[model samples]
Target chain A: MAFASSRSRPDPAAAPDGPAYLPSSVRNMVKLVVAGGLGVGKTTLIRSVSETRSLHTEEVMTAPSSRVDSLAFTPRKTHTTVTMDFGRLTLGESGETVLYLFGTPGQARFRQAWLDTAYGARGALVLMDLRRPEVSYEAMDLVEESGMPYAVAVNDFPGSPVLDAATVRADLDLHPETPLLFCNALERESSIDALIGLVSHSLDVYRRNTGP
Target chain B: MSRRRDPVRITPAYLATGGRTSARRALPDVLTRLVRVDGRAAASLSPPQHHLLTAVDGGDLTLADAAGHLRLPVSAVRILAGDLLDLGLIQAVEPAELPDVELLENVLDGLRKLKKPA
Candidate 1:
C-alpha cells in the first residue's frame, strides 16, 4: 500500500504558520471510526455505508516477538498496519455534513496507530467475527485503553454458529450499556444499519454520561 | 527627468555605529510577518489527511517517519504529506536516509535459504 505524500513543498504564497480555520458552521462535522481485526470486514462495513472513495492506508505488519507470538502460525504474514485505514460518510441527506470513518489496524503490534486513531473520536464500532470471538479482546482492549466508549458489531460469517446477544455479551464480558448487535457485513443494509445503531447508541451514552 | 545625486555624507560617528541597531530592529518585524502569513493556511484538514493527522497528533512520529512506519509507499505518503504541510497540520523535517538495499537483499536471501528444506 502506498502512503500518500505531498509531491511539492507548501506554496510560499499560501503557507500559513498555524492551523487553518474552518468556518464555525462547518465545524460540527462528526467522525465515526470502524475498528477490527484483520479480515474482520471493516472495509466492507465502510464501503457499504459510504461508497465514496476511501483512502487505502496500509502499514507494514512486523512480527513483534515481544508481544504476540509471531511464529505460532504462518511465516508468510509480514508487514502490518503501522498506520490506519480510512473512509468517509455523510449522515442523513445533507451533503454539507460529513462523517469521517477510520478503520484501525487490529493487531496488538499496531496498537500505537490504533491508539492514535482513537484520539478525539467520540466512539468506535468494534467488529467481531463470531467464529473467533476470542479475537475480539484485542480490539476491545484498545478501545478501553483509549478511554473511548465503543459498540460491538458481530459479523455473522456463513456457517458460523449464531450465538444470541446474551451469550455474546457474556463471552465478551461486555458492560451492560455497550451496544452489541449482529451484522452480515456482506449485505449493505445490514452493515449500514449496524453502523447507524452504533453511532446512535454512542451518542446516547455520551449524552447521558456528559449530561446535555 | 534629470537625476539628482545627493552628496555622500558619512560622519565618523555614523561609521562607528555600523548600522547594527537598524538591522537588529528589523529582525523581529520580519519574523512576525512570516508567522502571520503562514498561520492562516494551516488549519483545514482534508478527510483522509485528517485521519492520518489525528493518528499522529500525539507527536510520537514525524511526518516521514509516520509514512515509513505505516509502510505506505513513499509517493502516496508524499502526497498526503503535501496536504498536511499545506494545512500546517504537519511540518516536514529532514528525510531519513534510505536503508541499505544490499543489507535488505542479504536478509531476504537468508530468509529464502531458511525456508528451503535442509
Candidate 2:
C-alpha cells in the first residue's frame, strides 16, 4: 500500500503487459516504449514503425533541475518531457488490436515519466548502441529497476563492428532470460522485429507470472 | 517598457488559477480522457479548462495529448480536466480491474501475428 499513492508509483498488477480491459467504446489502445541512450535509434525505431508522424508533449524543467537533469543540454535548453509520441500500429486485418508506441526522452530526469509511460504498455524495446555500450547502461538500469519487461535491441548502425549476441549480453550483464536482438533501426521490418521480440518476451513473463 | 521574454513562462492556464501542483488532487492517470464534453462543460472553466473541453470534444485523447496540443504541462492539464469533470461536461473513462486474462491473450496473439513473415 505504501506505493499505492497516486502521485507515487503505479501498481504493477494494473499493467506493464497490457490494460486490464479494453473499453468497447475505444479501440484497443496499447502504449509501448522505444527507449535507450540518446540517438540509439529510439526515435528512429518509432518513426520507422509508426503509422503516423510521432507527437511529443513536454514539461518545463524547474530552474534548478534545468541546471542538473539533462546532461545533453548546453545550458540553454529547458524542457523535461511528459512524452507521448502517438504512433499507432495495427496488429491484424480486423484492426482490432492497435499498439501505440510512446517514445521516451532518454535522460535521467525523464526516468519517472518513462516508467509512467510504460504503464498499460506491453513492454519496452530497449535499443543499445553497440559502439557506445556505455550509453545504454543508464537506460537499461532504469528499465530493470522499474521491473518493466524489456528486450534489448543492439542497433546495427552503419560502421558498428559485428558482434555476437552472447558476447554482448554478457558484457551488458543482462539477465539471460531477457531477450536480446540485433536490428537495423532504419528498416521498417527490422524495427518491427525488435518490437515483436520485446512483446514476445513480455508475453512469456506474463505467462510465467500469471500462471499457476 | 523594456521587452523581455523568458523562454519558458508560467502559462496563463496555471496562473489564472493558483499554481499547478496542488490543484489536481482528484486527477488519476495522466492518460485519463474526458469521455464527454458538452455546454455544461464550459461553465466556470478558465481558458485552459475551456481549451481542454474543446480539444477532447469528439476525439479520444489522453491528458498528455491535450497538454501537448495546448502547450500546457501534465499537471496543468490534470487540474483543468478536473474542473471539466466536475462540471459534468466530461467523464473519466473507467479503468478495468487488473490480472485481465483475455486482454493478455489478445495482446499475445496480436504480437504473434506481427511476428509472422509478411
Candidate 3:
C-alpha cells in the first residue's frame, strides 16, 4: 500500500541533459519486471534503483474487464484498478541501455493484468517472502507461464525468521537453474545486488535458449 | 421554442479542455521512439497535443517516456500521439534487436559500477 516514490529522487542520468532523453550510439530500452507477492517489496526495489522518481501508473479496470477478469473473487460495486509501478535505470557507462523496471501487483485476480505488464519484458526478478512462502507460488507461476526466465530474491523483512535456505527453496519449488539471493529492498545496495543477480541470470538463460 | 446547448461543452461538468476529450487511441509499441516530422503541423494541434509534441520534439522518447515527461496518462497520450502519427507529424523509431550476450554484459557492467559495497 506504500507509494514507492517516497524514497525516490531525480537520477543524475535522467537529468535534463542530452543523454537523459536521447538515444546514444546504442539505443536499448529493455523492460524488466519486479515480481513478488503483496508485501514483499516489489515497489521498494524499483524505488531503490530508479534514477528518477518512480511513477506508479494506475490503470482503472472498466466494466468489461471486471466482468471478464474478476472471476472467483466477486467484483466490487466500484471500479477495480491495476497498478504498474514504473522505474527507469540507465545501464552501461554510455547509458545506451535503459532498464524500464515494472513492479507488478501479485494477486490471483490480477493475473491477466500482470501478464499484460510482463509482456515484452526481457526477464523478471521474483521477490520471495520467507514468512509467507506460499505467496511465492503465484509470482513464480506467472513468470513461468510467461516463459521468461526469472531470479528469486528473498526480501529480509524485519520480523522474518532466519531459516534454512534449502527448506525455503524446497517450499517454493524453484528450478535448479534459477538464481536465488537475499535482499533488503529498502536498502539501495542490497536491491541493486538482487537486480544484478537477475540481469546476470537472465543473460545466461537467454544464451542457453538461443545457443552459443 | 427549443433552446440550443453550448457547442463547446460536451458534459455538464467536464467542459475544461474545450470538449476535445480525445477519442484518440492506439500507439505503435511501447519501445517505439518518436521525433517530430513537421513543425508546422504541430501548430494545428490542441494545447495538450502541442505539449506532447514539444516533449517528443526534445528527443526520441518512447510513447511511455513522452507520457511520463508530459505527466499524462499513457492511454491518453498514446491516443494523441497516434493522431499526430497518422498525420506524419512524428516518426516512430522501432527498436533494433539486441543480442542477449551483449545486452546482459552491458547491464552487468553497469550494475557493477553503480552498486555500492554491501
Candidate 4:
C-alpha cells in the first residue's frame, strides 16, 4: 500500500489511543533500550518502527525535594522529572509477543533512573550521529555497564561526516564483537534493519553464553 | 486547583502504600509489563489499588503507562503494584532470564517481515 507523498499527511495508525490495550493473545513482553544523547533521533527511530503512537512517561527524581526543603523551609518541593518516550510493536501471527522500545537518555545524570528503564531489557540500540560521535561514548559505556548486548546505529543526518565502519569503530572505542551499522532514523525499513542487527547480535551473545 | 492557590499538596508516600515502603520481592521497574489476573479482587480493593487494577484491566500495560494513566508517581505505582501482587490480583510478564534465544529470534523475524521494501 503506497501513497503519493505520504509524509505530508498524518497517519491514522499513529493516533495516540488507536488501540487502548494490547491484544489478549500477548504473552511475552520484551523490552529494548533506545539510548542516545539529546537530539540523536531516539524518538524518531522509535516512531518509525513502533506499531502504535509513541507514549511518554516521566521518572521523577525524589532526592532534590529534601534539598529544597532545607533551603527555605518552604512547603514547595522541587523534583527533576525525566521524560522517557516509548512505543509498542506486537509480534507473532496471533500477536502473542510484544516488544517495547524505550527512548532514554544515556547521560550520567540519569544513572539512577536507568536502573528502572534498563532493568530486564534484552539489549540497547544506541543511536549516534557521526558528526558528533563523542556524544555516544556515555551511552556505549552505560550499556556495557549494564552487561547487556548493545548495537550502535549511526543515524545519518544531512552534511554528517561519512567515515568507514572500521574508523568509526576505532573512534568510538567499541568492542570488536559489538555490532555497528548505519541507518536513516526517519525511514521505517532502515530503522528496522538497525533493530534487526541489534537483536541478531543479542542472539549470538545468548548462544555463546548458554552453550549448544 | 491552581498551583498559586495551593502551592504544595504533598500526599505522604505512606498514605499510598499503607506504610509499606518495600514489597516482599524485588519491585518491578517502570518498564515491567503488568496485567490484571483476578477481576474479582476489584470489589475489595482500596481506591488506589482499584485504580491500579483498572489501569491494567483489559490490556497488559507497562508500570510506567499505569503511572502516567493514574497520574501517580512511579514510586507510588511500584508500591501499589507490590500490594496487588501480594494479593494475587495482578502479575508481571517479565521472564526471570534475559529474553531467551527463541524470543530474540522471533523478534528478529518479526522485524524482517515488517521492513518496508526499498
Best by lDDT: 4
Task: Report the C-alpha lDDT of model 3 over A1-212, residue by residue, as the tens digit.
Answer: 12333334454454542223655554777788998777788888888778766665454444443335544465554446566777788776676888788888657677866765676777898998888867767777888888997888999988897977787677777778888899989887788888888888888888888896
Best by DockQ: 4
- Please give fnat for model 4: 0.44
lDDT of 4 by residue, B82-103 (tens): 8788888888766323348888
Please write out the lDDT profile of model 4 over residues A1-212, one tens digit for every residue. Answer: 22332353356366444223666677767889999888999999998877666766565655433233223432354456567888778776777778889888877666656657788788999999988877877777888899999999999999999899999899888889999999999887688889999999998998888788
lDDT of 1 by residue, A8-108 (tens): 21332352212222222221234566877777888877765443434444433345423234333446674333445554443332233335567765566
**Position B82, candidate 4: lDDT:** 80
Q: For candidate 3, give the DockQ.
A: 0.30
Clash pairs (backbone) in predicted model 4: none
lDDT-wise, the better of 1 and 3 is: 3
Ranked by TM-score, the better of candidates 1 and 2 is 2
Q: What is the TM-score of chain A in candidate 2?
A: 0.77
N/CA/C clash count, model 2: 0
Q: lDDT of model 4 at residue A212?
A: 85
| Candidate 4 residue A54 C-alpha distance from true site, Å | 1.1
What lDDT tens digits, residue by residue, belong to model 2 across residues A112-148? 5565556666678888988898887877877777777
By TM-score, how accurate is candidate 4?
A: 0.81
Docking class of 4: acceptable
Report the error of model 2 at residue A64, Å. 9.5
Badly placed stretches (over 4 Å) of model 2 are A1-25, A63-84, B1-18, B22-28, B37-41, B94-101, B111-118
Q: Cα deviation of B98 in candidate 1 (Å)?
A: 44
List where candidate 1 sits over 4 angstroms from the true fold.
Answer: A1-27, A59-83, B1-118
Error of 1 at A92 (Å): 3.7
What lDDT does the true structure give each of the candidates?
0.51, 0.64, 0.69, 0.74
CA deviation > 4 Å runs, candidate 3: A1-26, A65-67, A71-78, B1-29, B38-40, B43-48, B69-73, B95-97, B116-118
